[model samples]
Target: MKKIIGVDLGGTTTKFAILNEAGEIEQKWSISTDIEREGINIVPNIIDSINQQLSQSGLSSTDVLGIGMGSPGSVDIDKGTVIGAYNLNWKTLQQVKEQIEAGTSIPFYIDNDANVAALGEQWKGAGEGNANVVFITLGTGVGGGVVAEGKLVHGAGTAGEIGHMNVDPNGYECTCGNVGCLETVASATGVVHLAQDYAEGYAGDSELKGLIDQKQEITAKIVFDQAKKRDPLAKKVVDKFSFYLGLACGNIANILSPNAIVIGGGVSAAGDVLVDGVREYFEKYAFPPVKTSTEIKLAQLGNDAGVIGAGSLVKMSR
Candidate 1:
């Protein structure tokens, strides 16, 4: 009957789940993330929802052991402080955690969202049973998490940032104020950018061209579908993007030497087309022993990884 609360805070939504000590979800809910307000303001909404759910279940806040939150910023884990969350406009992690704790007496634990997702995957998803693993999330923006030596590598809260690594130094500008970051070429948005660049000079007839009108709604999904149908231009775009992604994975492997690389996010739905291309390219780009040693697999946790990982914070902290 023991329970814990897991909070996954994102730019659009804040997902919460009540999990038993044995890892079963008792209830789940969500609220708008309120990007316009300061990060601290969202805390009361979260607490209120948790309390409502607990009351509906004939329980109380005291029945829960603690709360864990996955945030989108650098965190000082030891201090329970958020060092910087420019996107959330939060000045510190400690302030956000304290605000949430102030709403209740339970202990709170927080970490970067991607890192937490990695832990979630390791605990119950694709990375299960693997002590060393790399998790890459390919969404509007790319994010990553690393597990090494049976532990999540924090490296002072800045560790698993494969997205910001320089992949194409002269290619595109990223929101992180970097030029040619891996995220610029390997994320869902990155794929769209590559598709647009390819569509401009594409002469071959294809269904993709007809799908989007004058506005160039070129999305990653369409490009993936076209690639699935063997469209040459779409295939080229995917390959180009995949090559950079493979190279980035290889680099991460070389440094971390993880047992597996788990890729998540919407774009991963492309399945084998994405996996094979990344693996093939990794063989060509990766360092000697690194390429041969690591196992590359798609993440299995999907949307639940964030909250699931949040739920397992107690394990990660130890």
Candidate 2:
């Protein structure tokens, strides 16, 4: 019973999982991402952790198919190098393959975290093995990945960056040096910012307004909740967020014509309220053929998507 090893390396924590040949996760665990010493500890920590886990479980490189990993940055799959992930204090990481494969004696594969999450969903979540899928993650910011004909598209390394998709030329400035990116309006922080911007100078009777006036911490989830409770102000904000999200998805669908566009990340916890709102606008903006063919879906894997997707990378490569 050979297994696959998946590693989802994040800025704060790294997740690990063992999955059987059939794509079922057997055991999963985590380790804090040690960004100290220029992220030099990251690879060594991973190597040590995987080796220990395998040893304890009576497994070894022979029992494992491969190790797949998802990390944040521009990853050169061919070179096995990571370039400049500042959040992780990694200006540049070289010899990733040399370190991991040498340490573990197992072949290693890596990709951008967003792309790996998309692959994970396609394999075991909302995508359900769809030949073509678009995965959008709306967290503090937006992230996306594209799978075309059952293959992850890795064009120039950063191909599926939906968050940076320019939505407005004069809108809010994005961290990516763009004005009015999809992430500026569709991410959780984006949603909250939209709520605040809309709340200014409004003579409306609403719970959302009350929270804003009191300087309460208003999260994207709160806005969605208020919208569900029929709060007019919150409804307005959510409507705007959904419009931008749907418009983005609609355009992507027109270009890629994927089987489904799946939404994930923390903001997705808003669930049906978020999906329904996006769907309404997506239908209106999508091309006729795409509107009917490409389904909008919510990601089912949640926190596990990254690790699972990373595992799928090994299984897929085989």
Candidate 3:
């Protein structure tokens, strides 16, 4: 059986999968991300894992089709180097593709993690093969991928960074050192930040405020759950969160006019409520033509979007 190796290299864990042409996972596994020496050992560890897996599966480099990866930070695809991925300890330009191909002697392909995820959705998930699509992931931080004319857009290595869009000039500071980036209030932590901001001096019997008063952990999940029950404070947070995100999406729609803007990542699990709220604002802010043509939908592949999308890099190359 012909095989393709897909790697999703994340900060906490690196997930690997062997996928068939049908995009079905024949096997999958993960290893804790190597943190020693700013990821100096990460490449070696991954190569070793591939060799071990291939050996056990009675496969060899010649038997496999190719390998692809979705890695954090901006990727210089032609050079296979990763730039400024702080979490991965890949602080400088590392020849990721060259090192990996040398280690395994197998053809390798790569792209930004978010871009690959977008391709995955475009190919087999919510996008359903739409030629023009946008993928927005609301995790601890927000990430985005823009696809146009059936290809991922990586302009100067950082084109679809929707998370950094200037949503508020006076908003909270983001990890990117920007004030009021979309991520400051639209990500998972953004939900929590909204909840905490609304918790102070508001007197209408708010469970979210109570959680804040007691110095307890407040998560986006709790805020979303409370919103479901019509908790005023939680509703306020969700409404505001949805506003900025939708506005950002609206602006993007005007520019790219993608077929669908697929929302995913952990926060998207709130389901219809999140989608509906964003849709309400998206309609308000989007251009009339874009409003009529573009669709906003939730992602279908879940965690698998990464690996499947990574595999798609090689698949498309072939």
Residues 1-318 of candidate 2 have per-residue lDDT tens digits of 799999999999999999997779999999999999898898999999999999999997999999999988778888788878877888966678779999999999988899999999999999976989999999988999999999999886678889999877888999988799999999989999999999997788999999999999999999999999999999999999988898898999999999999999999999999999999999999999899899999999999999999999998898
User: Each candidate's TM vs. the true structure?
Assistant: 0.89, 0.97, 0.93
Q: Give the TM-score ranking, best first.
A: 2, 3, 1
Q: Write the per-residue lDDT of candidate 3 for residues 213-295, one digit (tens) a residue.
A: 99999889899999999989999999999999999989999999999999999999999999999999999999999998999
Q: Which ten residues in a row have the lowest lDDT in candidate 3?
A: 151-160
Superior candidate under lDDT, 1 versus 2: 2
Best by lDDT: 2
Model 1 Cα lDDT, one tens digit per residue, 78-173: 667775677766764446667667777677898889999998888788888889989999987888888888788877557878889898878899
lDDT (Cα) of model 2: 0.92
* lDDT preference between candidates 2 and 3, better one: 2
Regions more than 4 Å wrong, model 3: none
Candidate 1: Cα lDDT at 263: 94
Top-TM-score candidate index:
2
- Which stretches of model 2 miss by more than 4 angstroms? none
* Order of quality (lDDT): 2, 3, 1
The TM-score of predicted model 1 comes to 0.89
Q: lDDT of all the models against the reference? A: 0.82, 0.92, 0.91
The residue-level lDDT of candidate 3 at 262 comes to 98
Backbone clashes per model, in order? 4, 0, 0
Candidate 2: clashing pairs of residues = none
RMSD of each: 2.6, 1.3, 1.8
